[model samples]
Target: MKRRAWIVWLPPVLSGAFLIALWYAGRAATGLQSWILPTPGEIFQAAWNEHATLLRAAGGTAVGALGGFLVAALAGLAIALVLGGARWLRTGLYPWLLVVQMTPVIVVAPIIVLWAGPGLPGIITVTFLISFFPIVVNTTQGLLSAEAPMVDLFRMYGATRWQELQLLRLPSAMPYFLAGLRIAATLAPIGAIFGEYLVGNASGGTGGLGFLVYVYNTQIKIPALFATALTSCLLGFIFVAAVSWLNWALLHHWHDSFERHDR
Candidate 1:
């Protein structure tokens, strides 16, 4: 199984390597001009030269993403709980929730900036807008989708509303919550970057990767810009992998999703 996993990864690794070779060849063919595309070596050199600055940008972006994700998780849980407990509230609010999701973050971000006036608060608002929806939707579905018989049994045994929520509904919702979290982990970085693009500032000189991308592009440091962009992508992927591992660990014991047996 381990070997199979490695084998699966091998193709993508090789493909990336091949693409880099092609890129280098193209740069060579074009004489490594800055007006044209930069060579792999030049890009690597640029990245190395700006490694500290790039690292700082990466750290800032991660902080914003995580901060926003934390807020979203809490807010989503609260919203899901309210929806679960009150059918009328769910009916009234669900459509609006969907509307919020349908609206593009780019369009809403400027409004958020106007409301918040700027800085991390504005960025976090954008991040929250983008990351909160999946959590609420998935968690609400999980909470309300409890087995009818199981709920009846709980009621028969005199389970209070709070007891039912704590023991039955919340437990039932765990898998769905984790699934949403995995999605959020991937999305948070994107939200942060999008927010940064609008806000154009992060905590101090450690502005997020998007700001760095803007600066590098203006300076015509195409290679450095690409490197910073790639770094953000890699950061998002790392969060994805972390969430996947967490999901596997959390669900492997009881959930059929982790079953290794034949269907």
Candidate 2:
């Protein structure tokens, strides 16, 4: 298991290291000032120096992001199940779902913030809005993707719609649902950060990372700005890694995608 985990991680680690080295080398070759383009080293230094502030901001952001993600995951799954179970409702409302997804988040975020109020509620609402659509889309596709022959066999056995859905469709859709979740997990932090930038209030002496980004940028703390950016990336990576782990845990035993890995 440890060996397999290393195999999973080694390529990305190597690639990221190479990229960082190249970024540093390129900046050195360009003769740019730190204010213009901070190197990875400088960014690390700044992150370490401002660790207290960064950690505080990260904690605040994490709460909002996780809060929103949990809501989206539950609501998205429930809504998808409802839509999938009813053909008439799906036919009538599916387009509307698409329209909602099509609407730019930036356009609606302020309105959501205004309605939900600032701080945690507003943050969670923004995150849920950003992360909800993909779950519905992917899960719907999966529910619809069940094999025709198998479904007919179930029907021949006089299986009820609920029985067919519970036994056949839901199991088949697990991979797709997890795929959507992984995608949404990546977006959760961005939603949280954006929410913070727009309407976040300070909690425990620190604003969210989005607010910190603005602060650092306006203060012309270039290294700190870069550090904040790196911190956001780190947060995103954690979300993704967690979902990936969940995906592996659920699917590895039976799914074709992870079959080889199981051995």
Candidate 3:
């Protein structure tokens, strides 16, 4: 158990240490100005000094990302269900879905802001666009991946379409949906930040971490900028970790997806 724990924890610890060392070394070697590249200490101090503002900005970003993730998950699941249930619809719509996914969000953000009037709605729309495709594709694949024999058994048992879906298909899709959700959670923040970058504080306010990042950048506050970025990274890590825990909790019992190979 200790070895297992070490294997899981060591790499990240080492990597973080290495990064800190490198940052310190580079600062000492190059004698870079604080604005060019502040030391980790400077960044930490900035973070401590601006804790309240940073926390509020981080909270806004987190909320936007979470809200967008929920919206994407629901919409993706609904679309997947429609496509999975109707072969003709799947055949016709699948290609278009790919096109939607392929389209860059940068190109789409302005259009969304135009329609949504540049605020939380626009940010949420950008987040939704950025994170929507994976869930749709994964859930559709999962729903369709039901074992043939199981499906046949259901049919033979005179199971209704809804019954087949509820009993077999949806459960089979859970792992895939969860996997997509993990990916979506990570991407959601990026989408929210990008939206803020493009739209500014469109809600007639200072907005989220993205806006803070912009403000710090333009004002040449490198330590604060790094601190803001680190905060964003921490947020992403938390969101991903939360989803991973949920995945393990939900799937570890029956699903082979979470089965312990060592066991």
Best by TM-score: 3
| Model 1 agreement with the true structure over 129-217: per-residue lDDT tens digits | 88999999899999987899999999999999899998999989989888888888888989888878778553343378878877887
- Global CA lDDT computed for model 3: 0.88
Cα TM-score per model: 0.89, 0.89, 0.94
Candidate 2 lDDT, 1-263, residue by residue in tens: 76568888899999999999999899989999999988888889999999999989998899999999999989988888888877998999889888888898778777876789778888888888889889988998889889999999999999998899899999999999999999999999999998887667533222889889878877999999889888999999999999999999999888988656444
In the predicted model 2, the residue pairs found to clash are: none
Residue 177 lDDT, candidate 3, scale 0-100: 95
Candidate 1 residue pairs in backbone clash: none
TM-score of 3: 0.94
Error of 3 at 244 (Å): 1.5
Provide the overall lDDT of each model, using Cα atoms, as 2-decimal numbers.
0.84, 0.88, 0.88
Q: Candidate 2: list runs displaced more than 4 Å.
A: 1-14, 201-206, 261-263
lDDT score, candidate 1, position 83: 88
Please, what's the RMSD in Å of model 3? Answer: 1.7
Q: Cα deviation of 147 in candidate 3 (Å)?
A: 0.8
Which prediction has more favorable lDDT, 1 or 2? 2
Taking all chains together, the TM-score of candidate 2 against the true structure is 0.89
Collision count for each candidate, in order: 0, 0, 0
